[model samples]
Target: MHSIHNRLFLLFLSCMMALLIIGSYLYYRSTTEIIHDKIGDMAEKNISQTAGLFDLLLEGYDSVTKSLNSNYELLRLLELRDKETNPAASANMERSITNILGAAFYSREDIIGIHVVTHKGKLYNYEKRFAGVIDPGFTDTDWFKKLKDSSGEMVWMGLYDGSVINTMQKEAVFVFGRQLYDLDTYKKIGVVFIETDPKPIWAAMSNVTISPNSRVYIANNENRIIATTEKDGVETPSFSGLPRPDSDHVIVDKSTDQLIVAAKAELADWTVFGLTPKADINAQVVEARKYLLIVVLLLVVMSTALATLISRNIASPLKLLIRQMRQVEMGNFTGTVNVNSFEEINSLVSSFNRMVHRMDELIERITLASISEKNAELQALQSQVNPHFLYNTLDMIYWMLDERENDRLGRVILALSHMFRYSSDWQEASRTTLRQELDQMRHYLTIIENRLEGRVRTEIRIDDAWLDVMLPKMTIQPIIENAVKSGLEPLNRPGLLQVYTRTTQRELCIVIEDNGIGMDERTLTELQTALSDGSSAIRGNEGHVSAANGGTAGDRAVMKRRGIGLPNVHRRIVLMFGEQYGLRIESKEGAGTTVTIAMPLPSKGRKIDEHTDR
Candidate 1:
């Protein structure tokens, strides 16, 4: 590992050295190639710009020619003139032609001049110097001569100006002209012409820039080299550049051979070219490698330093911590953990000491609590009345009856038996199997029915599968008692009471509904108050009403008067299963009430609790 680390560092240095060497070469190549590539990209971008520019300029030129050619009204009057007979009338027609000419050039700054040539073998123009000429030798000027000679199709002359009569006003420019013919006669009437300046197109192409280093240029397909750049104006054919060698786009570098070129076609037989240097791409790659080598070296050096520091500072503290943890594992957290090497290690020791202190404080509290709890248990034991007192009292009564009054003894025995047996209340957590709660509820119901036999009707409906369900002790008996007491409220009129157990959505639902003197909202509210308060169960000696609703006394009482049941079974269920499976009370005044208790279905594999049926 040591040797490899040494070799790795050396390899790192050597690789960096090699990268520097290769990068130096690549950078050199990239830099030179970048210049060439830049020029080519510039040239290509310029080609596109130039093509767009050329089209825009062609639009202006075409509009000028169209404006002049489309004036068939002017052409119609001129074609009616008698050339030899009324020469003066021809001069008057020439003035209207000049007025129309000025309108064509109004927005077009690039059109140098415009003119019209009538087909009566008379050269009629807007200019005074060139007006009213009878070239009655019938077609001598090349523009007129060509229109009369052709089959009268629209004509576009490439680049010429001698087609006009005036010699000096014509500085040579591109010409666009077309013939006007009468539809019926198929006869040539006159020709319209417009001159276009190419500088407008060049001006539109001027802002072409491809890259910071790139150069942009355009060349005529016929061989005019018109190049524009960020630092240079339109390049003439005499500028230092290669001739466009027939190919649409091909890179050629005078400084170096690496090049990328793009070409676009412009209007009027013009081809635009863009040049890009190949070195720009290589330079970016080499620069990336140069950055990569720095990152690797920093990682190597930093890792070695961090690993050494971690071993010296962190590993020792961790070993000490492992030993301390073993003592804690052996059940000894009384001693202090020691660390002074680093802040984190010191923090761990401080935390360990604090935890040990907290445990000590907890142990002390627990010891005192255990003593208090024992005292409380002893006090509770003292408060419990001796069961032997009643047993002795009953024994005494039976003994007396055996001696003399046997009738009184039998009556006394029955009363004493019921007092202990029927009033036995179990704790909450003890589970009561469904069958057992039902039996207890049945016995309680029998007692209630006996009291209100002719007044009310009571029914119990239980599912067979639910018979084995285990619920908390005393969950149903209170409900049965409440149903009877509340449902048989008046001495005369009575209501129907129904108890049904079924399964709904994975829960056992114990629904107790009453059609009794269905409560008013106010009475129902009092019943609700009574059911909620366990303390409200015993109101000065009528007997204890187990809190059915599990609410405060007032809320329990409000529900108590109306609920027919305080929903105590609902509370016991939620206490056994979570709060999610709890009481849902839906009641309507003067109609009926449904107190639904939902409990979770126990898992099949759980062991049966010994106290389940209490």
Candidate 2:
């Protein structure tokens, strides 16, 4: 009893309110997730780049030490003994080694000092003073012990006070060293140390931090903080949770509101960590939520008023049109809707009436065409039992009788007569058992073999168990005829034709293969195309049947004329069984051609009776 406008207003308002609530929640959740993913990706990339820079720095210092290992003068000086007896030679050697160390120091700006400590309580230092044999107790230090235990590989020692070595530059420095060996003796001679300024590594670590309050630090495999951008924050950050070394690059801790991203450094088994506050990252989204709320409220009010006006004008005409549509759906195409509520609605009603009239005409035409095509196909199949095959066999038998009148001539004539009688009897049924079909094929082959006289050879290997399977009459014989005419007759050498049957649990396959001169790819494609279209072509006109079944021409010409047999067989198989059971042909130019007849196995419970309907 309610007017259309009142009902539409309430429905539209409720839908708009629900959509606004759901849309806002989805937008907020999706946007927040995207932002977090982007931030984490940025953090991982920055830390990886920073770790690469640290590796490059360490590699450069290690290269300098490698050059010193090959320096023969340095090796000779470390191997020197009896310096007291040969004081002049010793003094000259000391000056030579000092200059070699100075060249390495000037090669890179980051190298603060290079020191070599021999096992014999002697030291060679390259710094501001160039002190020779300055500290004899350096071998007892913990850094020296660790370097010796490194087994000749370079080892990184954490930051240490620089005042112990040189009082001029008192700031902390990063130290790394390796054990040196004599080139020829293969014995440990001394240890070489390279100390670099740690500012470059610290600078790279600081750039990955997102905010002032956020902390960035590097930790070793032992979970010890080796370096940090914020000294105090390393000891007393609000959150101290660390991810496992093998965990993903980023992790979120909801309890602490922190997003932690980590990357492994390439050189020292160290991990870089960037800790950021989630609240700071999502501050902009909180502000956007407030504006979204106001916009949703205004849209709901506007949509409700517009829906009421539109529904009132559309309701009456649509109701009349729907009533006529119901009648059409029930097969009454004569009814028409009569309404003039709006211009669009009036045009729609006019189009519906015309469409119903056209549909009725189309259905009647399709039904008549289908019935006519089926009847024509059946007629074409019946006409394929041509009498020309009998005339050709009889003519061959007459030539043999006039020449020698041998027993083979009589046998060929008997087989030819049997084949004609079997093919001509079409009143019994359209389908026959496989045993009858194979026996008919043997008759055809016997005539073909006698005429060719050792030029053609054939083999049949059908299983006795498959003899009772039902199929269209004279199906395989036509394919054999085509093979002999088109595939064998053109060859100069003796041709081989093989007929075989293969049975599976679900289907039966009859294969005809020939070692005759086969068709090329282009000719085979055209023949297949013609066969697929032949079913409709033969049914549409009577002249096509004559062209396919009657002609006085060569073997190829006769094949082109009798091509209807292949398609006629294929169509009969499809109509009786289904589209899935049909003929498939394969051919190559020089090798051969093979045609397969694929059909489903007959059910064991079904009897082969004289029933016409499959």
Candidate 3:
């Protein structure tokens, strides 16, 4: 015997443990998804808004360049060629252009310097100190070439050091350039370059990042990083792995533990990438998981302790019962178990005490009646064999052979003989493999079909996998007999019988269904009541089985003549495999009836014994 306390404790613990594990997994998964989605949405919104701000800033600078291009005085000065011959006229034009450039520079506090490079290699600069210069090599610079090749569109030339004229100012500045054209000639004459302090743009990007380690940068269509916010780590933000700028707003790259959100600037062919680490984005989820794990562990401990106490309380009564059982096994039937616990356990104790008392009394009288009772029981067992069925079957076979003498008659005789021999040969064991049982049922079905003259059709649809399982002998045959006699025989139309098998995680099921005259509601209720009444015998008095089958007097007599009924089969199954495995019946008045025999899968090397008739 095993310790009932431990079994109870483990059962409780296992149930709670499974529930906790499943619940925790679902909670963690949902929380992580929610956190990821929330962070992605926020990141996308922030990047989009920052891109808008950056575009507006660029547009403002473009407007300034357009205003300068339209200045009549500045246009005339650039078109003038006599500036080299007339120093007075050249000096006046240079001062006038300087005033115009200075007025545009002071319009925005962020503007650092503005320089104009003419196609003739002449350079003009306007800055905080107005230190102008005329550098001939300005046309050879990359920024100047980019501006000249820009056609008529404004070009943002990324961040660069201070201009040549204002080399003393070491601060970095973002430069915008455009090619200036002579309106009347339709030819490019000069390039206008405007530089702005990068502090404001950097501030916009910095405000868009939520984490300290996060990076936000602007990249061209070629994926070159133009500018980025101040970064503390060596990890450089790359836009090459991001999705197309017109696709989804955010992309989560779990491989790199990063979430990237991107937006395209409308003013330029530049994309803004905001990269945030997953660890930082899911920080709350991580903390929640940690606390949930702790709580689950604590709950496990508390539940275990509680289970121990409950199991002890429940096991106390069972332990008392076992002690009494042990005493009885030792031939002392005077002792009885008495323990107070649940009502069910208390009832069990009461029944056990009553049984012991009865056994004690019976033991005193056993010697006086042993011989006579044994002889009577033996005679009853021997008489239990119903000779009428065999006689009728053999007589029918004889008549059929004598009258018809066809292959059909021969087949019926052969099937009947096989069924008789199989049922009578009880010398080997009470249990048989499911395959053998099915074979026996096949023989019985063959005989029934022949007798019914093709009025009955049968179908068997059981999986071969469970054919090797062991079950009680005569388990399915009796149910089939009941279906044929009570359900099918009375039907006016052709009858169909089906036998199939199903399996669950723990139990195997064999189902027998018949399209015959079924029982009404009242008869079914009474039959079900009798089945559940904990009785070992099914009574023929209530008409529960007979009425359901539309039983005639002859059918009732035949049923009574046989010693077994559905109840007997149910009792045997319960005795062998506990109450969890047994027969279930479902029936309708006009349709048919289905009977299910549920059993546990047999373990390896385990043999089940058939219970004696009660």
Candidate 4:
């Protein structure tokens, strides 16, 4: 979760997907509306053109009806037929009427037949050859009555399977008729009916098809579907449910699953309606959506790839910089971050490099100054101890030589020579092993035992295993020397000094305990307080060393004449290790004093030289 690459990739991907989804939705919405509107408009225009074509065809039919109705010769024959009484003469007049009807039928090729019925019940018919004979009840038919009722106006009788006046003429026909009148008298003499093939009307409706599944219908004023392109038994919508037709403009109704485009034909009481299923209408839109989806998918893939690449580009350099920073934290400041990346990241890396370099320099300077300070303090403390200790040792040897102690003279000189050699050499190391410190202490004790003539005694009970532990040079010598002067020298009885080692889980302790008259509580408290106050290791001892008995000022002066005391040793140990490891003193008036030096437990083969100046 802390990985920057994953975070950046997810952030970029989410933003891109959101934009793509919103943009696609908006574009698709607008496109669908535009396509739907365009398709509807095209269908309406097609249906309107078909209606206009039907108007032309109907106009031709109307002209044919007018020519026959207004012909003077045809009217003269009809009048002659009505006036004649003889059967043979009336038959000839009938033939003359038949010739006139035959000529009118031949004038128009679409016309299937022409029939004229006089007001006196005589009929003249001219029709296709082999057409069926006329029906005897033709005058009693609804179409004939409608024609009679028309006052010289044409009446359209829609479509029929055969001629209205002829029986068994099974070809579909479009029929229309008008009452014939004598122009001068303005009187109706008879009704004329013309039958034409309905194929041209059907072609007009079919020619404007918008789709393969589209159905075209010719609906009348009453919304009855008179003609349609749909096959029989195919389900069709109720025309009454469609919007009312307007002759001046096309109307589109989308109340159903089909797209309905309708317009009224100019010359007839008919509306041409085109119905196309919505599925077919939106097929193009579906295809467009498919392509759009493909494009979106491709874009998404590209966006993901780009996001991953950018995240990696930005995060890779930052990760490298973090690794370098961690190395610095581990005290390895030598490494520098180097990468080719964006300008901002490069700048950050440059700043980090500069910081590492500056830190390395500052730490080196601080370490040098600390080491100088520690060396100066060690030199000062060593200077304070050597003069007083050397004088005391030399004076003891002078006394021994004066008393003519010839037998022990060589041993005392040998011990004094070793002590001077060990203490005066400050060029090498300022620390020594516990075994070496103990050996030096043994040499000093031997001299003390000889001087006091067995009045003072010493016991060293350190384990051989702890002999290899390292501590500061002169660490044990001063503490043992101070114990001999302050506690054992004033003893009225034989004095005993013991040195032993103790161990805990985290630290090792060197306990130097002496059987002598110990200091009082006030002195012990003052000594402890001096240790806690971080007393300087090389400071003068006027206030630090208190008298061992009765807290006398002369005793304090005598102690001052001695070497550096436990407080300076405690200060040195605390500086070398940390504050947690230091010196603790337990002493009671008239009882023995125990000075326990506490130090860290170093692992096997561990070197502590680096902490000498700490």
Candidate 5:
């Protein structure tokens, strides 16, 4: 009903008036009541007190780092420079002995001393600042064995009593240590440790002034609150001061709010939580409004100016462009927005027009050209996978034929014949029993075993209960392929692959575990990207997900290639079942990997049928 220019100007005026009125009212109410004062006081305490506590937590983690560096110093001292060498007595290694002890006792005012043993069982330590020659025979210690066996450049120890560090009747502190290696030769240097005096972290919070009675509870990233002033004791995980959505500030996270918690973060990942009387927070805010009014007025003027400028510069063009956009909303593509003032907006209109024209042409051409070329490429690559599999199967059949000269070739042929027949049918991802899928996997692995000459071993634990439990068709193949192609291939050593299915607490969990060398972090990251981008945005949920392995979905559909195995398998399962059911991959270096697919078990009244393509 209104012209574009008039409507935009009116909207601009309305926004300005709203800002002014809202700002004035907020300013007046906040000033008239002193509520903001309490918030300011609480905020100040939270920032300063929490900041100190935050620094302390960081110091703890840093003490851990400095403790790690102590090991580096120890390596330089022992000249056991490489990780493999036994850390025996050495003059060069003795120079850093003080730092090693320093780091070992850095946070631990309680620890009076520390002892280390070389592989030959010789002892190392300065017994006492006053007393001399305490037996440093630190044999049969877990830290010693762990230090010797660990391959990591730096290994961190969990909490240990300071008894070893302090045999004296006096000083005792908890200790955490790390192992060090020679930078070049990769030989083991001696272990370095730091004793922690958990007191300092609490000391930082002791002075946090909150209504004279409030308390601060600190928790590390792991939700472990090392120390608390509460006499009630942190017996369980019940120390508060964490995240809460009810009040923008939470007194204690994941627990009841008998306490008002203002939670914040430190320089490190540690969460700093301060609990004050809720009455105090409300009290502080009560007196704050009077003083904050001056600030609020200035803010209101600034906000009004900002709103007007934004409206004139941004909303004005968008409003004007809306006329053209309305044409778009009306399904008109040959239209263009008026090139009034904003250069980018003018350019955007031009680009939008060009895109509309280009897209129409592309759609028409793409629809025609896509099916032939894509189908051709799919056919070729698909064949490469099938032939390689068949050759492996035939080679195995040949071996069996040689071994069992009187073999019933018919049985082997029937199995291989059914496998290829299913592979070609491509009518999978419907309802099927777990027994059938495992059968398919067995046939596939037979071909692999033929290639590996029994070097690759597989144990299929088709549990009795899961025999009739149905799953999406061919859901297990890609996971198997990924495990074999990526996980097992690098091992060079023969490995084990186990497939197990089970239902627990109403969920069907199918797990495939392999003992082959697992992928590194970079490979996992790639796999994640491949999985996430498998299905792109389409008009509805019924669109196809291209399984271009190791490729991201994008406007650059030109070279889009998704992996068929994992992505396709994951999509089919999730689409058939619900999103709660999906593939989960876990792997560690040299430790192998486990891929688990989880889905809801079928209901009693339900029956599974292959969901045919529409």
Candidate 6:
């Protein structure tokens, strides 16, 4: 046992096991105590608040009974009931008494009915319409007897499953009654019973519970449960030796697996108890302890393996260096390697750390240089687009002149001049407002309408509010030209090209739709694939354009030569923003094509709301 290996093994195992067990016990004890105190306090406060609410509710019922008890007209009407000998007069007296009862019934929403029963066996009720006929034998009921014995005071009869006065009233109700007496005679004239729905009482009890499985009980001064949230057949725990009626403090009973918090409802002369299963309260603590055990076991096993590793391996520093080297090979060069060992090994580690530092610096420089070169190339490609577009515009002018179409030649020339000026401002042309871009597009459209002889109709439905949004210059014109030439030109019908904007929470989309000869599936697929090819776009290679709209070889060649416009725009948008913002295209054989340019919305989007509200 004194051997170095055996001694170290036992020492490590014992120390780890002791520390883990002690720490876990401490954590478990602290956690359990905290949860118990916190949950008990919360439950106590909840019951107290609920009890206060019940006090207020019962006080309202007391006030309602007091109002009926002291009303002079009601007492006089009841007294006149005995004196009226004629049948019709007696019936009128009964109506007057019910009228007073109806006033009280309407004052409160919870009241199901207001009932008055006299010693002469006369019954008057002001209840809900269609409440069914009154029970004639209600005078003989136990509740009526209890109310008759009350000394001109309100008697809360707790909750019942039905009304004693109405035959068909079977819903749960909270009932209270009071004896009405004449002011001068101090004599009992009749007894008033107010039957109200028990929803308010149930709500008060439910509000005091901590969990869905927790049971709340309301017990009278005699320790008899008057109202409870316990379901039928569910046994309730005994609440023996609860706090006195005058005590405001809660009595916390911690049994084997249950926690009971009891508080007194001072005004109602009742006790409210919330019984919650301790299993629900300690569920989280148990889970934490289970995880602690698992972690402790894992640590013990790892400690044993570490002791064996230290005993067997004398070159731990070299092993650490090798691990760091493998991490470097995986391209994680963030942390340096430091090891205490022989001079030669330490020297080697120092050299490795220097190498990693230099390599990390070189990698950062290369990344930045690559980004700069990419940006320069994108700028060059955008510069090439303007001259190419100018050549096409001049070619259109030449054709019009050659065909002796002199009527619209001046209009085309004017629009061309405006477009040339707009395109020449290349210093800040990398980005411009959407309004400027649309203005340039309008000029181009003017020339197009003249060149195509009204064969193409352009509609720009962009809201004026979106005019200030900034985008790359010449973005819309290139797409418009492509649509007019490739899609609208070959159409047998008049082409309608529409431009509009759509928005969402994350992005805004500019949609260009054309009711023209749309591309077939093969051609559309090829175009989409070319646009997504970043390498080809960065290398500025002319991508292949498939035969579109069932056109001929010459048509395919024209499209092939002009396909770079879309790719250029897609690449520029992605390079400016990120990979997520780009163009999306949808087309069907004869259903036309919709090209949508999706980009992030502005920071404020104050202009967006102007159109979105519509």
Clashes of 4: 0
Task: For residues 263-314, write the lDDT of model 5, one tens digit per residue.
Answer: 4443443445555555665454555654456666676667656655765676
Per-residue lDDT tens digits for candidate 6, residues 218-322, read 887767777889998998766566544455676777765778877876557678888889988887678877887888789888978887766434356666777
Candidate 2's C-alpha lDDT?
A: 0.69
Could you tell which candidate, 1 or 3, scores higher by lDDT?
3
- Measured by TM-score, how close is model 2 to the native structure? 0.43
Q: Can you rank all candidates by TM-score, best first? A: 4, 3, 6, 2, 1, 5
After superposing all C-alphas onto the true structure, candidate 6 shows an RMSD in angstroms of: 34.8
Q: What global local distance difference test value does model 3 have?
A: 0.74
Show the colliding residue pairs in model 2: 548-561
Which scores better on lDDT, 2 or 5? 2
For TM-score, the strongest prediction is: 4
Off by over 4 Å in 2: 1-14, 81-89, 128-141, 161-164, 233-257, 283-614
Of 1 and 6, the candidate ahead on lDDT is: 6
Q: What is the lDDT of residue 294 in candidate 1?
A: 74
User: TM-score of predicted model 6?
Assistant: 0.49
lDDT: worst 10-residue window of model 4: 542-551
For each candidate in turn, the TM-score is 0.33, 0.43, 0.52, 0.59, 0.31, 0.49
How big is the RMSD of model 5? Answer: 47.9
lDDT of 2 by residue, 1-614 (tens): 37565676677767877887799889878877787777667777777677777778778877889888778888788778324448788888778787899999889887778888776656677865443234446566777788877777877776666623555556778788888888888788888887777888788888777666567877777666667776553554432357644422433333457767677666676777877778766765666666776777677667776676667668777777788889988988777788877898889988987888877665554454344334433443454555457646666785777577677877788787677666766657667888999898898889999999988898999988778878877688777877776678667999999989886786678998888777666656655675565444432221221111211234433433323356667666765555576777787766778888988875567664322223
> Would you list the clashing residue pairs of candidate 6?
none
- Superposition error at 552 for model 1 (Å): 99
List ranges where model 5 is wrong by over 4 Å: 1-381, 384-415, 427-431, 535-563, 604-614
Worst 10 residues of 3 by lDDT: 371-380
lDDT of each: 0.54, 0.69, 0.74, 0.78, 0.55, 0.74
